[model samples]
Each structure stands twice: as C-alpha cells, then as structure tokens.
Target: MGVSGGSPTSRFECTRRLSAADSQCIWNAIAEIGARVGDRFTSNVPLFNCFGDHKMAVRGLVSARPWVADDGQEGGGGDGGIMMVAGYPSLREAVIAVAKKELREDRVSREQALQLMKEWLQKSQDIKNGRLDDAFILRFLRVKKFSVPLAQQTILKYLHFRNIYSHYCRQLDYLEPPVYELLKSGYLFALPQRDKLGRRVIFANAGKLDPYKYHNTDMAKAHLVTYETLLEDEDNQVLGFNHVTDLKGVCAAQMTLWSPSELGAIIKLGEQAVPMRHKEIHFLNVPPAFRMVYDFCKTLFSEKMRNRFYLHSSLEELHQSVDPKILPKEYGGTIPMSEMIDMWMKEVSRKRDALLSLDRMESQKVMHSYKPRTTTPKASNGITSLPGSFRRLEVD
Candidate 1:
C-alpha cells in the first residue's frame, strides 16, 4: 500500500487502499518525474542512491519468515509471532526516529540532510567492500536514532535537487539550437566507433546505385553544406570565416568570435558531424572565399575525425598548400582510391590468413594433446625422468 509520510494524518495516504493498478499508476507518476532529472546527480555521482531504506525494506520483505513452532505448541503457539515481529521497530524505523528528532531540533538544513544521505550511500558502498559492517537493519536503526531530522532533510533535499536539476537540464536542452536542428533534420543516429583509439569511424552501407554512394564525392558535398548551415545559424563570424579559409594562419591560428548559441552550435555540430556516413569529403571543394569557413568546420572534429577526413586529397591539398607534410605519401603521397582500396583488401586478407593458420594450429594442438585412458604411461616410475607430469604418469 502507498503511504504518504510528508503529510500529516492517514487521509493523505492515497495508496493505502489502492488496488494494484492504482498503485502502479501512482508509482509511474513518481518514476516519470525521476527519469528526467535523475541523470544530473546520478550521471557523475557514484554513490548517490546506494544506502536507502528502500533496499532494506526489499531485503526484509523478500526473506521474512513466520516464527517457528514451539516444542509443544498448537498452531505454532497461536499467531506465529508475525504481528509482534512486524510491529517491532526495524533499522528503517530507528533511522526515521532519529531523523524526526533532528528535524524537531533544527540541527541541520535540508541540504545538509541530503549531503548526509549521499554520505550514507558511500557508506553502503564501503560495506560492500568489507570496510564497514554489513548489518543493514542495524545500520538503518542507528542512522534513524542519531539523525531523524537530518534524514528528513535529506529526503526533502533530494527531492528538491531532483526537481531543480531536471528543470535546468531541460532548459539547457531547449536553448541548444543544434539539438533543434538535429530533431528537425531527423539525422540523429548512433555515433560511430572510435578509430586508432582516438579517431571516430562511421559505417554506412553505400552499395552501387545510391546517389550518395561515392564516399569522396557525394557524401563530402552533403557534409560541406551541413557544416556551412550549422555555422551560419550560430552567427559565428570567426568560425564562419574559417570555414572558407585554406591557410592554417587564417583557419587554425585566428580565433573565431562566436556567441554562446554559436559555440553550442559548433560543439553540437562537431559531435553530430563525426558520425556521418562519409569521410573523404574535403573543404577545399568549396570556393577559396569559403575555405576558412570549411576549415573551421573541419577543426570541430575530434582527433579521429581529423585523421580520417585529413586522408582526403582535397583536404590534403589545402593542408599541403599550408604545409607539405600534411598529406601522407600514400595518395600520390596521397593514395589513389583504387590503391587505397587494394591496400585495405590486402591487409584484410593477410589478417584473415593469419587467423586461419592460427586456428588450424590450435586445432592440431588440441588433437595432439588428446589421450585415451587405455594408452600406456609416457613416463617411467619415480626413478625415471619425463618431459611432463602426464608423460611421467603414462610411463609409470
């Protein structure tokens, strides 16, 4: 049954008489609120919800038993002691008592109480590590006895923080323009796997007939447009200018001034653009006037993206114009598409052959190691030497 602790009197306990369905509805309402704001504290805080009374209640409820029968009693000595034991104070009860006392005394603020709860959660974790006593009921009782007001404050503080944090996060999401753009474009998808431990890798199925199939051509065009639009919306003139620049001094060294919306847009766009299906697109394809803007867009990528996208010749050419070493020797010192593909295929085949050989060797080893119980011992008795214990046993 649902119980309301905050309000005085039994009349406020709506769940007390609720049916299963009604109880579920009430719980769902609470959970819905929790889902939105729960991440703020929980995402970074490790021990946020560990030492709660809910856990103790769950443990007690799951393992409770009726009193055992006396040596010569009828019907297990009248009501099985269930009512008495159930009525008796538990750890949770003691904690509640202490929390109440503190509340009456005004010994702690609601925020302090919440901090205590967080501390208690850490204590619970310590218990798991054998650093503290694991007596759940006893611990609860002790906490209740010593800090009733604090406990109450903690509960209130938690609820307060949850509500506040949730609202704030929602507001942040609302203010983020890129998020709106993403939602509008319906381009949201799972981010790609990271490459070379630092670079991001996006996977796409671009078989022959698709209009955007060429990784270097069509996909690049789409990314260029997307990057430009994202930059324009931010009103970030520096980044905007960089998006079109080719020179490192113009694109990388010069700082672009952008508003908060522009900065947020840049961050979000960088994160979002990393997972797009193509990597070979180049910013140089855009006119020289827009090269700074394109470079600014390129700069937003993580190291992985830089590595992958830098592989494109248009990108390399732009880089080489600024610095010759920027493009690797593979693709005319920049690898051709056919040569790159061939190199990738050879690497794949080499690895595949190695794996097959390793597997075959492992299989042969397993077969060789197999022995029948009927076979003679390979080793002589204690007086003789053998290569292994099994060989010695076999010889004997």
Candidate 2:
C-alpha cells in the first residue's frame, strides 16, 4: 500500500465519496508505474495496497510522470493529454498536488514548509548547501511525506555527512588525477535520458575497474561523487532513481582492496545520508564462480535495499526486471556504456572548477559528537554543544 494522505474533511451538509471511475483510474496509474519501473515498483508496494489516502498520495506520485500514447499519438483516459499516476495532466501539476496532499497530512502548509527550510539552512553550521531552494527542500519534504521538521532533520544530517567527507564532497576536481582515474575507469555512470517512468538510471560497472591501480576506496568515493553531482537535477530528486551494477569481473581478490570500513561508509551513504529515492537495483552479468563474492557482499546491504536487489544471470534474464530498451548495448540494449561514460565525464569536466572550490569552501559548523544537557540520570546536568570543536582534537 502506498503512504496514506492526511485526514480528509467533510463539506457542509455533504461528504464526497469515491466513484467507481476514480478507483479504476488509480488502478490504471499503478499499473502504468509498475510497468515503467519494470515491476519493481509493484513488487515493493506496501502490503495493504488498498484504496485510501495513501493510494491518493501514490496516485499523485505516479501522475508526476510524463504520459504517452499507445501508438505515440495520444493514450487512453488522459483525454489526449499526459496523465500522471494521480491523474494529473502534467508532472508539475502532480508534484503540486502531492506537495499539497503531503503537507496537509503532516499538518504543515506550503508556506510553513518553505519557512522551515529557510530556518534550517540558516541554522546550518556545516558547509552551506548552495541548493536550498524550495524545489530542493521539496525533494526532502516529498521523501519525508512533507513533514517540515523531518525534512529539516534530513537536510541537517546530509550536511553533516558532507562536512566529514569534504575532500571528496567539496574538494573533488573531476579533472584531477584521482578523480580522472575514476572517470577513465568507467566504474560508474548515469544515462542521458530517464526511463519510461522518469527515473534516473545510474550504473556501476563493477568489473570495469583494474583493482591493482587504484584502491577500492577511490572507487567508492568516485561513485559517491557521481551520484551527489547528479542530485542537482530536480527531476532526479523528485522522480527518484534506479541503480544497476555489472558483477562480471568482481572477485574475492578485488574485494580485498577495500576495507570493511570503506564499504560500510558506502552503504551508509546509500541507505541514510543520501536524500534521493531508490526505487530499484539490478546486479547484472553475475559470474557463476562469484559465490564467495556474493555471500560476503550481500549481507552488507540493508534489508530494504536487499529486497530491491535482483541478481540476473544473463541479459535476457535481466530483461524480466528492467526494460532492455533503456539499457546499454553491452547488455543487449540501446546506449553504449562507453558513450554514456564519456558524456558523463564531460559533465564532470564542466563542473571541475566548482567541484575544486567546494573543498576550499567553509562548511557549516557540524557537531561531530553530542553530550546531552542531562546525563540520563548518570550524565552531566549541563552539556556543551560542540560543532567543529572536535576538529582540533583530530591527530593526523
């Protein structure tokens, strides 16, 4: 079941009831989203999956996608126009609708949400985000179901993660040797176009790397760099993203290059700090002899992420989960991984100066550790809040 919306109200002397047509519309929208995401969308749906406020919210999310015609002209029920999952005529309308519905449920208004974001940004002690606009904040709000406070909390946590990883976060210059090695390695990439559902697709070529040249930490950091940069796109923030990794060359030996701590950080970034929706994940071309690799690697993912992971033995097998049309030619699809990587690298090059300047940019004051004002019956009654105060204590 999708997320339930806020409480509904009764009009004076009357109450509105859902019509049969409305129910059917929701069903259609769900089916379409399910199709666009290659069934993962439906598979991951909440168990209840019944018609209710959550369905309405889900509908709004669905309708946020661009529509199409069966024959490429015009489609059904859309009245010759695009229909979102929520039955809106356009993505903008659907985002607005979802925003309104979510805020209403959270007991917050649009103005309040906007104000809360402003206040959160103002209080940020770490590196200030250059992207604190309504649209950016709205992405967090959407993920948190428009709960202004929760969204604010998420933003703060993300900033803290950036502060700690400032070298990669602010100082990374894509053209620099460290970063360039990553781009040339073709270890990670994003497609130029969205899938049928308007979600961005990011690929991690697990086998593409030469493990001996660069440490696995470099691979992990580069992957984070690519994803973080892509976060600037509004559509990716809203519609969300899909991930695929080629496991063709990954082996136990390659695993030895990265320490457990580095791997944990990557997982944390994916499951916690990142503010984007992860709709699905695919592991393609998994080699049969990679059992040791699978056993060791699988447990590292969170249950929710693990549930989304699909191991496909072959390209044809993967087509069952992802549309082959959207994949690269190496996997029997349209685009070439080489081309995608090249284009993405060029994008990184274009942002080179900005990325380098980030390292030099002052981060907002972020608390490295917390001492509560109360000692929980055994702690200090008065605690000191230290933001960046601990930085001086770090040795080497």
Candidate 3:
C-alpha cells in the first residue's frame, strides 16, 4: 500500500493482504457503520470510508501487490505496504482546538478562570451544594467566553431558575415512567448527523405527543435530560446547536399546553441557563394560527437569540438555513427518521448511568434566596493576653 494526501486529511494505500479473519472483522465493522464496499473479500477493494464526530473520516485501503517506497525501497521487503489507520483528531482534541481559537481558552486561561470560579463559589450565597468540578465550571466559562464574573452570574441564574421551577428540574430520571414514555414517543430528539457547521440539531415535533397523556413537566424533564446527554459530547458544546421544530400537526389545543409564564421560563432557560449556544432555531411547516404562539415565544427570546430565530413555510426554506444532506428523509434528507431517532435513543441508553445521576444533583431549593452580607463582621482586637501571663486579662 502507498500513502498519499487526499482532500479529507491524509489518505493511506494498503498493498498488503490480510488474513480471512481480519478481513471479516473489517467487513463487519464497515457494515455496522453503514458504508458500502463492493465485496467483503480483501482483493484490493476499497474497504470503507465514513466521517464521524465532526469531519473525522475513517477510511480503509487494501492492495494485493507490494508497495514500493519513494526511495526505491519496498515496504516490508516488497511483500506489502504497511496497513495504516488514521483519524484527524478525537472530539476532545477538536474541542481543545476550538476552545483555543474561538473561546480564548488555553492552559493558563483555563486555570485562571477555574480559580476565579472557585473563589466565587466560596462567597456565593445563591448556589448551595453546587457542582465545583472543572468540567462543570468550564461549561459556564466557555459559554461566557471565559469571563469568570459572567460565568459566575450565569451559574447563579441557572441554579435560581431550577430553584423556582423545581417541578420541572428536580428528579429528572430518564428511566422514570413519564420521562421514558415521553422520550420513546419521538417528540423530541437530536439528529444523528450534525449540521454543516458541526452544530447539533435537536428536532421537536410539537404534535407528536398526546396533550392529555404527557404534561409540560414530563416534556421538560425529557428534553432537559436529553440536552444533558448531548452536551456530554464536546463537539456539541463548542459548536453549539440548531433547534428545528416541526409544527406540522400542532393543534390549537397543543398551543395551550404551556401557560404564558411557563413558556417564557423555558425560553429564558435556553438563553440564560443553558451553557450551549443557540446558533439558530428553524421552525418548519408552521401553520398560520401558530404564528400567534410563535410571536409570544419570540417576545421571550433575548435580542441575540431573536436574530437567530427563523420560520420556514416549507422544507425547502428550511434547507436554505440547515443543510438538507444531514436531515432525515421526511424533512428532505437521505437518512430515515426512524434511524435518527434510534441513534438518539441509543445515546440516551449509552449515557444511562450519567443521566440517572442527575437525580442526585442539587435539585432541592437552591440557595438563591440567601443574600451575602456586604459588610464583614469585625474581629475583636481590643483585648489581648500578655505573653507568659496565664490569667485572662480584661481590656476596654
């Protein structure tokens, strides 16, 4: 096999023959990834190539003949070329790169930011028993562009929101009957494929759920836990998200699902509490009547988010905003909706333990009600005991 450069990172050529068992293993893995390679046999056929996790392409190359080096030396004594498997970078590495370039994050800044957060947490009376790990702190820091004060404020606000909406935020166990049923209902899910800009797309079908069966609290828990699962992937954090809501079958009754205040709270949560960026929100197949509800929601969005909000009358218009290539077939894409929803369910299952542990989070009344005393209590310095004097001395 020979190694060469190609459009996607680097390309490798394989001029070596593999054992039947090895070939079968490769075939199985390739098939699992849903890529097509003509024959299963390793007869100089290109095995498979597919991109995963933000443009990291995995390709297989096989050649029957021995490969010669550029310097006239044969690879492995002219028997065959070395089989090479290469990937661009892991999601963590890619996130690091993105953080450096976009979030102004590096070792020095990260340490400094985390230290500042540590100090803030100590003095904070708003958040009690809050998460103090680097991952939790860095989430806010990154969203605030590493401004420690801003991140601190956001954390406090987030905890405060949860405090006020304990019904929605507390005990968010995905395995719970209500949450599990809502998740299985296919009402809301993250698309298997990311958008063109590598941002995760969360699809919500407003009409998919039965209003009588699933309440707003159930919907809230399901969506919140799902977002938590998606955010575990660093790619989603840095690149942010694109929310696509299909209002095809949304009825007037469904519009009344949430009270005005409740609806506002959800919108505010996305803007102020959540650490992920709202790159764009595409509302597709909107009925004329839904415009009133959409307008109400729009009023709740921040000015920055308001700019990213878009309404699409058709899938064609949606494709203009979001790439159709990554969308499911029903939405004018190649992939099937069932497959994408299954992918989301699998992700939820894979992160089952972590998601369930959310129940252990500080869901009880967050200490937002407490206010820090601005004036420090003065220590008594008026009295002192003389050295070598074993008796108490009185002083004015």
Candidate 4:
C-alpha cells in the first residue's frame, strides 16, 4: 500500500500515512474484498472511498463522487462484479504481466525503478517524504505504454510543470479569490457511479458556469486538481475514465475567456503530461450560439482529439452512451449534483496547502537531468490483438 500524494486528505493519503503495518492492513482488506468479489483472481475488486463526510458509491474499480452520501447511506456498493471478462487473464496476472514488461523494457526490477525515481524526485527536496509508490510509478509507465525511459521523462516533466505553473506545484491556494470563484461557478463534477462499462465519468457542466466569472485558466487548473485527487485510486489507473461536457449556455459573451494560448497549453498538458487515460468525451446540449467558440477551439484539437468529440442534441441522446444512473440528479439520475459540487469545494479547500507547497518547489534545473526521450513509446494496449468490439478511449 502506498501513501496517496495528489490530494489533501485523500483516503489514499490517509492510508499512505499509516504505519507499514496499517498500510498492509489496507492491502489485506483489498485482498479480502477481491476474494468476496468472486471465486479467485478474476472477481471484481471494490475499494470503497470517503471524501470528508461523503461516501463514494463505487464498483468494478475505485471511483468516488466527491460528495456527502445521501442520508443514512453507508460508504460502499455491492461487489458481485468481475474485473476479468470473456477469456482474459485474472486481474493479478494482468498487473504482474505489466510489471514484468516494464522491467524488461527498463532493465530494472520494480524495486530498482522505485529507487531510481526516488533519487531523481528527492533532488528537489520539495516533495513529501516517501510519497512515491508502486502505483504512482506504474501510472507513468502505463501512460507511456511501458517504456521505462519515456515514463521517467514524463515523471520529470510533470514535476517540472508543477514547479513552474503559477497555480500548480503547491502554489494553489483553494481559498484564493480565483479558486473560490471557480468553485462557486460549478464547472466540473465527478459522478458518483461508474458508467455501465465501468469507466469513471467527469461531467463538465459548462451550462452551470457563470461565463462572466468563469476563467478558462481556472477551469484547466480545476481539471488538474481533480485528476490529482482521483488518480490516487490505483484501480482507476487500470479501469480508465471518460468525460461528458455540456456546453449549454456557451455564447460569445463567454467566449471572451477562451484564450487560444490557454486552450493550447491545457491541451498539451492533457495529452503529454497528465497520467490518466480518458475513454471519451460526450458534449451534450451544445448550444448553437456556441458554434463560433467551438469552431475556434476545434482548431486546437487534432484529428485524434476531434474524432472523440460527441455532440448530442438532447439528454436522451446523451444517455444512449452514458448510463443515466451515474448522471447528475438534474439529468434523471439518483446522484445529487449539489452534493458533488459541495465535495469539489471541500477537496479544493483541503488540497490548497499541499498544492501551494509544490508550486514553490522550483524544478526547472532538475528537469534537464531527467528529460524524456524524443522517441515516443507506445506499447500494446490490453486488446489490440483481440477480436471484435472495443472501448473507445481518448485524452480529454
């Protein structure tokens, strides 16, 4: 078990801070949950999570809706699920295989990789003591398709970005006026339930945003903060995530905030730096008035990015792809949208100090030493060799 590093007060953080024995207990609990999920290693492993007073309802993989639970509800969901389907290998086997592959590619065992990264990461002396974990290392590897050198490079760049970015690398004070304004505007939500296919959903309720007060820059930072928190879930690293953005009230009035430079910067961050792999983006309720804005924004998107853009005219159409059960309460689901909003606010509040700490770390000089390879590396994703149906994954 590893201490979670991205968000403040994350259960991953809480569990990570636990003494070795307690952290082992959490792993024991995980094994127990996996056992109860089904017969052997193929069963679904569920890890229930809590955010402040909220109990995130989760299944298949670890995903939490940052909100207080509905009245009287305990913090868990049914585990009669399966992680391995059809004729695939067990979950444990999958992880082992990936680890082996990474070792073979990098010419180092898991322990060696961890030690190497620690040496590089500790050079800045700005990170928390013993914050690096196997899962953290695995994410970098997974994102870079198991290329050790590439993953190492991404790790450095991520730290470098935080060191330089004004709002990130610990300089982010959630209590700041800009942060407060972003929270009050309600630009994002991580739904309480995974989609029918088990992918986590991130809802960008652009309609709920007050265009005059909503800064696109803040929106991008909000995404980083959210990813930092949610990516703490180890299983989510494998299960992946999808996004649904509603551009309902977007108009020329709001377009004033859409700076091309700001959009491009975020696009690069999402594609090259962020560790999570997104499944898709469903842009529902896109207003006709927002067409000009979308057109300009589309230019920043590449063929890969544009291909995932889904524009649905109505809620029914959107639900065709996304299960309504995991959608916001206003969108015909059991989830409480207000609670999700409240959770996001609390998350921001808790992470402010840690974020600010990273902001001041200044890794510009350190990055030069660990710069990633110019030669891109992408390994075989789980199903490339398999037959038939597939899940469409994208970087949001």
TM-score of 2: 0.63
The candidate maximizing lDDT is 3
Assess each prediction's global lDDT (C-alpha) against the native.
0.28, 0.56, 0.61, 0.53
lDDT of 4 by residue, 1-396 (tens): 111123433544444445666445444454465445322322222234422222211221132112122221222121112234122233334434443553343335545666667676676454444245565677776666666688777776676565445444343555666656665566775664555544557788676655456555455566676676556554456556788988766544344343345456656655676777676888887666555456667667667777877878999998898878667788878757786566556544544544554444344444333222232122224322112221122112
Model 4 residue pairs with clashes: 3-16, 169-358, 169-359, 170-355, 170-356, 170-357, 170-358, 170-359, 171-356
lDDT of candidate 4 at residue 232, scale 0 to 100: 54
TM-score of each: 0.18, 0.63, 0.70, 0.62
Q: Which sections of candidate 3 miss by over 4 Å?
A: 1-11, 14-97, 118-128, 363-396
Ranking by lDDT: 3, 2, 4, 1
Candidate 2 deviant stretches above 4 angstroms: 1-111, 124-131, 350-396
**What tens digits encode model 2's per-residue C-alpha lDDT throughout 1-396?**
122233222211111244557645764666665445422232236632664554544444334333332322212111212323335434444434544553352334656777877776776665454465565566677677667778867766666666665534555556557667777777787764555555667878877666556654466568766766666544456666788888776644455454455556656755666777787888887665665456556788778777887788787887787767667787777767686666667555544654455444344566673221121111122222222321122211
What are the clash counts of all predictions, listed in order? 39, 21, 3, 9
Top-scoring candidate (TM-score): 3
Model 2 residue 106 CA deviation (Å) reads: 12
Per-residue lDDT of 264 in model 1:
40
In model 4, which regions exceed 4 Å deviation? 1-112, 119-131, 168-170, 214-216, 343-357, 366-396
